[model samples]
Target: MNKLSRLLLTASSIAPVCLTLIFIGWMKDSRSLMIYSAITAFISWGLCWSLMQFAEYKLERSHKIIDSLSPANKEVTNYFLSYLFPLLGTDSIAEKKEYAIFFYLSLLFYICFSENYNFNPLLSLHGYKFYEAEDDTGVGFVLISKEVITDIRNKTFKVVKLTDYTYLHTTDRE
Candidate 1:
């Protein structure tokens, strides 16, 4: 099944369990508004899980598309982004700030707020590895696992078109 379908299935299955837990105070032994709390928790968990899955699906798909595009298309993508984010534009600062905040929140939400079952590329690749996001260059810099990095360097996973940006894998502290 597709990623969205899998995510929806997982969420539908888990929502009930979470609702049940909230309804019965599974761990806290605290009294909840039972039906109301259960409903809220159900909605919250289900939507959150679905969104997590959606992001993972998008990221994976984006990587595949980026890896397959031609050099001309890469140039087009860069040109579009550059024009879209003109530095001297009146709202550029606001746009940049908004994107930064959104990115930071996504990082926090996916990394810290999510459970182990939630999908994350960073976690899947390597734990405790650092990564950098370069917007202007249209590349996500990552400190991937050694095995993955080796594969990348060996051309197993080709970056189809790297016009202006590419991740630099570094382990040196200094």
Candidate 2:
């Protein structure tokens, strides 16, 4: 993935938190914050759509047989909670807002530079599932799929490489 896509994916990984921040801004009657948060939410969604398009028309895809798989949805819980749970605490909006901006920017930079498997709930909401998977030769990567992989022993997936450590897995289920 490109730097822009990586940055967008990093932003989108916090999609739920963005929506909540918007609501909090409204609840707190801060018009400036509410408007800004709304804009951020909209842009985040646009980024997701663009990524989908890129994956469909741009990424080189191939079939791969995965021999070992384990669900990795729990990773999102930790990353998400770190961004969200703090909002529920006593910190003021200004403090959290600044911290979040700084944190997200830093995360975007890191993601753009590093090969990492990003577990995103927004992608989950879009019918994607995350898994820790390995091939017969023990090569490992995070698989993002649309189908619930029940049989973990061996499965052939249409894989789109998103990064060195990540793949977008597709299969006909319906």
Candidate 3:
């Protein structure tokens, strides 16, 4: 399904779970239960927001690098976050403020109903050591100062550049 549908599904799926907790609290007039529910919601939504922020930060950092190199190659400016999270396409990237607002709203909804649901942490969802081939044409991939790409035989990730091979979407190399 699309991002909107997936988002809706996530919100809908979590709602009943959280509402049930709220309902239990109401039935028993238990402040503790209510507080617990609230905490759970906050944590769940907070983490989600943090993850988005982290992704944004990564994109922005990449953007700066792209911009710095824009003088020589103007096309790099077109390399957007959509390229990273294809679920959100070029259109969404254009209206970043709107997307951010909607994402916040969605997180609020998800949090309200996220209390009782069990979800894996972000780390659990994807392991590190993700590799994408350097495929930015001649430029290949630019290495981040602290980033290290392991050399596994002939195939290895180049830390500095986002190669098409390592671009994640193109090759599924990660």
Q: How far out, in Å, is residue 57 in model 2?
A: 3.7
Best prediction by TM-score: 2
Please give the clash total of every predicted structure, in order.
Answer: 0, 0, 13
lDDT (tens digit, per residue) of candidate 3 on 77-167: 2322211332333244232434433543555455434321122223223322222223324433322222233433444332311222112
Cα lDDT over the full model 1? 0.32
lDDT of 1 at 39: 63
- Per-residue lDDT tens digits for candidate 2, residues 1-174, read 655656666677765666666666667665665666677767887887678667856677787788888888666666766456436632476345675456446655654566443577667777888889987678998787788888855556788777666777754433
Local distance difference test scores for all models: 0.32, 0.68, 0.33
What is the model-wide C-alpha lDDT for candidate 3? 0.33
What tens-digit string does per-residue lDDT give for candidate 1 at 20-78?
A: 33433433343432444466445645564544344433423223212221111122343
- Of the two candidates 1 and 3, the one with more favorable TM-score, higher being better, is 3
Clashing pairs in 2: none
**How many clashing residue pairs are found in candidate 3?**
13
